[model samples]
Target: MKYLIVGLGNIGAEYADTRHNIGFNVLDALAGASNIAFTTDRYGAVAELRHKGRTLVLLKPSTYMNLSGKAVRYWLDREKIERENLLVVVDDIALPFGTLRMRTRGSAGGHNGLKSICELLGTEDYARIRFGIGGDFARGQQVDYVLGQWTEEERRLLPDRLKVFGDAILSFACVGAERTMNLFNKK
Candidate 1:
């Protein structure tokens, strides 16, 4: 089987290591865990991971954050991967930092990258792995909060958190969504 795992984040020096780029961080973790190298190319920086007889395509959209749809649609069409076989990893502020959530399908909930993807695909029924960035910002501070780099405390827990998220993502790709959710999806 084949899977398309797309990580949503902005491209550029400024967005690296920021809360909004946690998805990219997770994709980095996946590459490291698999001992695979992401090569620069057309769709995006991509690495093919083979696990337990399955092929997993990891992607970090090069179209930046808001225009991520183009990259996603292109990849999905080129790979002929079903919408259900695509997993989008994204950073979510509604949940606490280091928290991970896996859902079979759901709305973007105001995430620009996700919203763009939904518009391109014309559907929301795809798997998703959401890495919590924590939300406690004041009004009009949402942009700063997400685009900001991780706090000292969040950075402290970054390693273990990334491991957990990485493991959960692998499980999802190797096994099934129901099983992955059962093993993850907890406080």
Candidate 2:
């Protein structure tokens, strides 16, 4: 079986470590833990990993955040992967920081990258792992905050939180959505 694991984040150093890059960070943790390095693939940088009998194709889209659908669709089509087997990891400003949420299908909730994938795929039926970035911005500071990095205090707790998310993603690939949700929902 094949799975397309997409990490959504903007390209360039300017976007690194921003809340928007949480997806990238989660993917990074997975790569490190498994010792699978991502080399540039057809549509993005990809790493093929086999953990616990499951094969995973980790992809960090080169299309940037807004147009992530382009890379995602390309990989999905080329690999002949089903929509259900495609799991997208993206940061969510709607959920509180350090909280991770997994869903089978839902609207983008104002997430442009997810919105683009929904539009390009013509559906939101695929799975998504939403890494919470917290929403505490005043008035119209939402953009600035999402594109910014976590505070020092938040950074201190990064490892524990990211581990849970990483394990949840692995569970999603190893088990199924229901089991993954059950395992990480309380984490």
Q: Which portions of model 2 show Cα errors greater than 4 Å?
A: none
lDDT (Cα, tens digit) per residue for candidate 1, span 24-114:
9998987998799999878589899998888888999999888888999999998898887899999999998888899998999999999
Error of 2 at 179 (Å): 1.3
Position 161, candidate 1: lDDT: 90
TM-score of each: 0.96, 0.97
On lDDT, the leading prediction is 1
Q: In candidate 1, which residue pairs clash? A: none
lDDT score of residue 31 within candidate 2: 90
